[model samples]
Target chain A: MAIRKRKSFFDIINEYFGDVEELANQFEDMFMEKPSWSQKNCTMEPLKDVTVTPKEVIVTVDLPLAKEGTIEVKPLDSKTIEISAEMKRKIRFDDFGITHHKGEFQRFYCQTRIPVPVEMDKVKFNLKKGILEVHMPRKRGERIPIE
Target chain B: MSEITIIEKRNIAPDATMLFGFPDVGLVGVIAASHLIEELNLEEVAYVDSKLLPPLIVLHEGLPHSSLRVFANNNILLAVSEIPIAADIIYPIIQALIDWGKNKKAKMMISLSGIPIQERQDAKELKVFAAGSTPEMLKLAKEKGIDILGEGYMVGPQAVMLQKCANMKIPALTLLAQCFYNYPDPEAAAEVLKSLANITGVKVDIKALLEKGEEIRLKARDVMKRTQQELSGIKKAREYDIPLYVS
Candidate 1:
């Protein structure tokens, strides 16, 4: 006969802390309105959407003028990502019928904190039609021995 | 004070068809409206003024302009906004526009917008759908070979416009093209404009719109960002929900 053991107290504590940390991160991301970087000097933050599922977290970014080869996605930590992409050409404010702003932008930058812990080493990304999509698997819960 | 006020810049044709293009999914409406204004050489006819609007003014040619303005030619009036209308004010803003259109004895009102679709990037051809306030309008869309959206949750200004028009017995139709949910999609905008031509019997060259798709996407990023903020406030994701029909 095979016997199944219950989870240890240490495992329960670890999972409880992990879930609380994830919830706090999610609340912060949801409520924070300002971009992590400064907006001066014609710098722009690309619009992004993050969807967290049980298995993975998917992030989609709108990089309007970006070329596929110029995009860079890096994980700053287990819960944070940094994305930057250079535009194919500089876009001037005057090009859009605005003359008050006297500068142009050649790139988009953003740093966002993911609401859930993810496997940073296994992150995968693709840029298509000026949109960048990143998929990261959720970190597996640690296993503990049952006495 | 009224929640929204329309200030007329010039006398407009009373029987013209009115078109509305506000910021929404894919930024489709704004792009299509801008193209229509350029192609048809529509001139400013009126503008909306509201205290509820954010404290912002747009400058063009060294002249101050309302963030939300109306343009018109002999056959049509186009109402477009440079910024996304906040969710709290969408109801009043759309109400005021519909009331003004009704008072002007406009023949019909049409809203050009987009419906978000999953896997939009993989779509080779986008399809346009229509929802009408009346059966007569639905028949018109059918004759024009546009699919009818029988059931779905609609968000933003167009959703309010449709409801108000229905209540006022004004003929209105909303044309929605399938598009990416969170990206500026000029291709979807082009598709919506093509559908507009069929329904309104108005034609404009779309070659330029397609050629400058990337440029438009770039220029519209700021507005799209603001729109993304307002969309969250309005619970715009309800547009994707499956509705429970209480028949």
Candidate 2:
């Protein structure tokens, strides 16, 4: 009694290309060194973990000393995330018993690439105990029931 | 040529309890050892030298010092490494250290270290576990209310230390606190030190260490990064896998 909508030829081709693009992006991230800005100055690249599941991609960043309400998470594109946060106080080199380096750090900055295509508009984030967790749903085609 | 050589600068008591603090999960041992050195006012008594080691020297007060050094007072001899030890050298290096400890007639040996937990960040209270190389050491740990690590894969310098100590018949125990695998966890270090005090009667106030936890984490990032690199080469992920029970 019900009619099923068929996927068009162009839609199938687009899906195939999307998968290829994701695979290529993953390969690049695996082989290429990520571009980081920490070498220039006092900026630090916060340690992070990315776990991709069937439903969503979860990213957790360790941002110790990060102040509440000063953290920002922005999507550079559908496949990239930019995270920045201000530390509660400036940490001097002397603080760690290193007096030779006369510098201080007040911020944590990093740009992480997501391996899978994500629905950027639906990205959600939460910062707790100085750890930032970002969740984004995987981009997938509509599911159809098989008769 | 020996893979490692320990050059003694000062003679310590023959009945000393040697403590090993090598870089491992959470950098717990190194942090705990640094705290012990400062709090106990331990002096550099020996240094390890080897061509196999990467050309690295730590500077203190504008003076160059070996990356692997031993500190001691009257009753305690502490061996600590500023950098991570390469995997290929762990067995030989640990064997040498244990043999040297035996030559020194150390009564007992203990290694301060950490065990990684999946939800370390969410843990409200961290627990310290002990793995003893001998039954006497295990009994002592039980007497001190320290939980025994019933069975698990331990991968690092401490693992080799435990193995060598067992073969040499030296009483050794490895203390591990639940902690973040990649993060410098001073709080976990404090917990391990507390356990150390309980078992060995070597006491050091951990207030300053606890107060400066965040700053220590911030500064230890570079060392932690290097340690993470070495961790892969050492197959540290084995610590996370369930060990098979083979009779």
Candidate 3:
């Protein structure tokens, strides 16, 4: 075994500042527009099927871990609906034997533009097994007239 | 020359240099920080790449005496205020905070978070945790009745900030409260904020949270109704089967 001599104070300072500068460069790269995993606010799982009935357009959204409240639906047109929801929550890192505690998070303002004109006034919503369902009634005038 | 400005609202000297976490992770530290900034009348000292891909805003404030920079983004505002656990390192991101913190001569830093929990789902009692630079910090943690957990993986910006601070030899601690994993839990955030106010001696008005809670509650209920209806059609069907094994 050979004994290794300690580095000089100047060497340590140089190394420390050098690492800091490298960290600065790394920060620049991290802040850059990163693709493939950018979205951080809301996790959206688009429904498997958005069925349009003669009287109503049934829009289903896969929202697991969703609360019974916090969904907002706005109708843009006879064929378009905008959906927004928020889920505010807190998490203890301890009970889970965790070290970090992310505080006072209200997962709100998750928005989605739905393709289908639904009646805003008569809109219906439901939550089951972490899934969200929205029923938008079709506009009366949009229906085909039968003589 | 790096441009710097000083903000003198009051002579309020901050004991801990806080790395204000994102909006919705452990409990909404960033939002609380925003509220503090508003309350203290802090001024913007710098802007670091607010127009990056995801978009973030960095502001500087030397409160009463201490100088520190706060980095935030529109994404943080637009986000659901949840802890981001995306499996990306963003190591460079943490380094940036270090650089920013060092520029202000910050001796110690704190990161805030909210963890999801099943117990106390309805009740509110935020537990504080600490991960410091040395044994002295650990002693402080014991004095505060705060547990110092040795290990666990943390998510989002705070996680990165913690690593950076530790690596840079800056005393750092992460405070978090228990929260629901799968729902918008404003009450939980409120609890965490109250604890934070107590810890940092920052005054926080709960009026905004109450108002926001009502608005969000109504929306959550509506969404839950719709979700239930959609899932009603899904049912499980099982058939009895006999397995054949080869001799």
- Rank list by DockQ: 1, 2, 3
TM-score (chain B only), all candidates: 0.98, 0.98, 0.60
Kindly report which residue stretches of model 2 are placed more than 4 angstroms away from their true locations once superposed.
A1-42, A97-102, A140-147
Candidate 3 docks with a DockQ of 0.02
TM-score of chain A of 1: 0.69
Ranking by TM-score: 2, 1, 3
Q: True-contact fraction for model 3?
A: 0.00
Candidate 1: segments with Cα more than 4 A from true spot: A1-43, A97-102, A142-147, B1-3
Give the per-residue lDDT digits (tens) of candidate 1, residues B52-150.
888889877677889999999989999999899888788888888888988888999999999999878778899999999999999999999999998
Q: Measured by C-alpha RMSD in angstroms, how accurate is candidate 2?
A: 4.4
Please give the C-alpha DockQ score of model 2.
0.38
Q: Please identify which of the two predictions, 1 or 2, would achieve the higher TM-score against the true structure.
A: 2
- Candidate 2 lDDT by residue in tens digits, B181-246: 887889899999999999889999989999878777777777887798899899999998988888
lDDT per prediction? 0.87, 0.88, 0.48
Error of 1 at B60 (Å): 1.5
For model 3, how does the per-residue alpha-carbon lDDT over A59-123 read when each residue is reduced to its tens digit?
A: 65544334567776676544456665554443222322434433233343333444555567898
Interface RMSD of 1: 2.6
TM-scores, all candidates, are 0.86, 0.88, 0.44
